[model samples]
Target: MSSSCPTNPSSSTTRPHTYNRKQKSLGLLCTKLGVERRRIYDIVNVLESIGVLARKAKNQYTWKGYAAIPGALHELKEEALREKLEGSQGVNAKVWDDEDDDETLSNSGSQNDKSIPNSDAPKSHKNDNRREKSLALLTQNFVKLFICSNMELISLDDAAKLLLGDAHSSSIMRTKVRRLYDIANVLSSMNLIEKTHTADTRKPAFRWLGLNENQSSNVINSRKRAFGTDISNIDFKRNKVGVFVNGEFSQKPMKQKELEHVSGLGQVDKSNLKHCTKQSSRSYQFGPFAPASVHKVGPSENNSVKQVHDWDSLATVHRPHYQNEALKELFSHYMEAWKSWYSEVAEKKPLHIL
Candidate 1:
């Protein structure tokens, strides 16, 4: 028997349900499972990919229940088979060579692809750069690995090797692993699969939750809890009728005076009222409709409107007395000398160099 196989199948089957659907911290899971944090992460990633776990927040996951696994696996299998058929039929005629895959992987991950629009053109070119590197697309491929393969529990190293092939460099493999880690974290949060140790070697692996025998029962109970009696007693109603005049769809209009009155009432006065009020009194300041005299600034006080100062005039104003007379004279003499030298250079004929 392979070391990856679970020694105790019963314990493995019941382990996921023990956590329930509550949000659990990664540390808590690690402590409970008696596994290393890194190993727990490996397990969480693969489980999350299949929709059994969902991430609530940082280092926290909500179990979505294992009942969703069967349906998800079925859908994934169908998709895989469909893709395989399409490939055989030459539907995807573009042969993805090693160079192309490397280039696509390199360009697609890590950052947002934004294109600057040409102002001269009426329509801007659509950015096709994002489609190749989309997280959603990466997630789909990651899930496809489980659906297409016969292996029940796959290690991250094995998965990376299989997906990228042996031709890819170590750095590329590392990049692929990092992307897989992200995908796995998201999938674990969804509760599709869960981390587990293999039976023989104690190697950390992801066990698919869909294969559980108790899934149907759990799903039925969950549905019952969610819907209660509401689903069985649904009441359907007819469409509401609108007022129609003659052949045209029209309703009675309000009088102009009435409309104006309503509009006036609807308009809220946003301007703040200024008034001297005692702090102790509750009714010291009047509301928005306060008298004009209460809002007026006092005659002795400066006007609220700002006075614009002439900064440019101040900047241009010369203060010759503030400068050193000797330095100023020397600068002026140098400026005259440079001006004369430049003028003489401009007057001279162009000299040809051999």
Candidate 2:
């Protein structure tokens, strides 16, 4: 069976005074669900973006449910339209298609601070930087891209470029893709988006279904995931416990793809994809999530990956039965993450396993 809603959490780190961290929804949910704090943040940010939840107060959020989605999308579409109109009128609209997203997000994040007269300068600056790159804000901006535009399919690389604007460094671009991968997952569970591929390039991309389209099925089976649990969301990351097949729980938690679903980016460039076969090893600028290895470069051989000739089959075979883009990406990570990881590991490694 499939379900169509997601849950969220609300957090505020820069409270004026000390607050109870454990009592917050983020912490409480983590305890109840046995999930890491960061995972809670990911779900919260994406759910809040799609109107499944709303920030009520510090560390609190209201359950808006799936019913709120249509209204929320209407508001987003209208806001996007207004930005377009402003752009046409030379009003310097900052929300969409700005040349540099760093400036745009920084400016957007600081609008509230301008009303304060005596806030600490350093704290405010730090808050601005955090908010500019926040997952919540990025999710909203990504939604605006689909809500306002006519394009049905969008690749994550293109999304990163659009959302990052002119401030796209390899590191920033990689982070953006990882964030987008997460947002796609939460939305995919709700059937708001579907994973597809571009016809011309045959690279994986996502298609918009929003809330209007209807797909109801009891079908719950995939090579990588099981429909047996009847849960709306699937956990791709191994639990905190070690994976011990025969011995003690001594194996590290799924020492697998930290960077998932990157083959579609072709090492951040479609034109350079063919080079993957030629380059056995390349220098990498490791991201925050990169594992430390004495030899940062290695051969391109996928030790245990299934031999798939193309992205289309790879995308289709290893993923869940549903159209959840996140699962599809995760399935390919174990297979292709090896091939692309060393090649694009530095600049384009997605932050976490989705």
Candidate 3:
């Protein structure tokens, strides 16, 4: 017997019901939970101590199969009976710490002439705490934007546009997108992020999940409460019609005489009149039509908008490819000597409101 992965009983009651006795590798679970592999093994040991049965599936320990335990509705409602799913392993300190380690370092740095240390350098525990706090702020902002946008999930491009302020690095941009994907995967595993498919069918978009029955019910109820309070109606005939009579189509409009000849109007005028429909609007003469094109700026146009660039330039000052010719040559020499990975961070685009 192995340990049971934490289960949220409240989740069982409120989350959308699914009866999948599926098996997933412990490595995959660790990645999703943002924990070390060894930590997962320790968790398995702890779960075995309790009655929660787990067993090795392939190379991983998955929840053991069992029939649904008989319990009354009152037992299900008892908050005490609900197991703590998220609290399993007694709070993973490392996962929490890894999330922070950035900001702690920044606050400790002095305004000395010395260049700021690269992210690769080792930092104290205090630095790690600061980093976690910074990550938290970023995550909170991202979540808030997602909720208020009234958009069902934004695309990767749109998401990049939102949180990452304009700072350019093709490699850095990819890294940020990858990091966002990792965070999203964690939320999705917890059933907090809902996945949506793109029109291409290959790419997926993630939205803040309305997880389970309770959440869905709350959303529906909220909409119902607003119903009939401020109803809007449209005048279909005038506003909805899309016919372009005076534009390009009118330049070569079929003359009445041409229609008359086609229908033998001289012999019977009513024959040509019968061809038109009751919904037809009167025709008018017009000239050639050409639609105007909307111009869009690409990522490189860093023309200082509102804030003159909303990014931490301090971070990019140390990059190998920065504008200084001497630093570029110096860094290039070192980089060429040893084939090590030097990842460039991508510049984020400005937030798109629409």
Best by lDDT: 2
Model 2, 1-354: lDDT tens digits are 012112221123233343333233344433433345565557766766655455444443444333344444544454444444433343222322222232222322212222233453556455545655667667766766655555556788877776554455798788779889988766654556555666557666776656323221111111211111111122233322121111111222322233224324222332212111110001111112211111111221221111112222222223222233334333233222322322222222221222
Q: Which ten residues in a row have the lowest lDDT in candidate 2?
A: 274-283
Model 2 TM-score is: 0.48
- The runs of at least 3 residues in candidate 3 whose Cα sits more than 4 Å from the true structure, single-residue gaps closed, are 1-135, 200-202, 211-354
Better by lDDT, candidate 3 or 2? 2
Off by over 4 Å in 1: 1-75, 88-130, 211-354
Q: Per-residue CA lDDT of candidate 1, range 1-354, in tens?
A: 112222222232223433221213334433433334554444443443333333334433333223233333444444445545434343222222134432122212112111122331333112222322334344545555554544556556545555544355788678767766655543432333344545544455554332322333222112211110011111111111111111111111211122222111111111110000000000111111111111221120211110011111112112222122212222222212222222222211110000
Provide the global lDDT of candidate 1 against the true structure: 0.31
Q: State the displacement of the C-alpha of residue 273, model 1, in Å, after optimal TM-score superposition.
A: 76
Best by TM-score: 2
The C-alpha TM-scores of every prediction are 0.33, 0.48, 0.27
lDDT of 2: 0.40
Per-residue lDDT tens digits for candidate 3, residues 174-219, read: 7656655544533332233444544343345665542222333122
Which whole-number lDDT from 0 to 100 does residue 104 have in model 1? 22
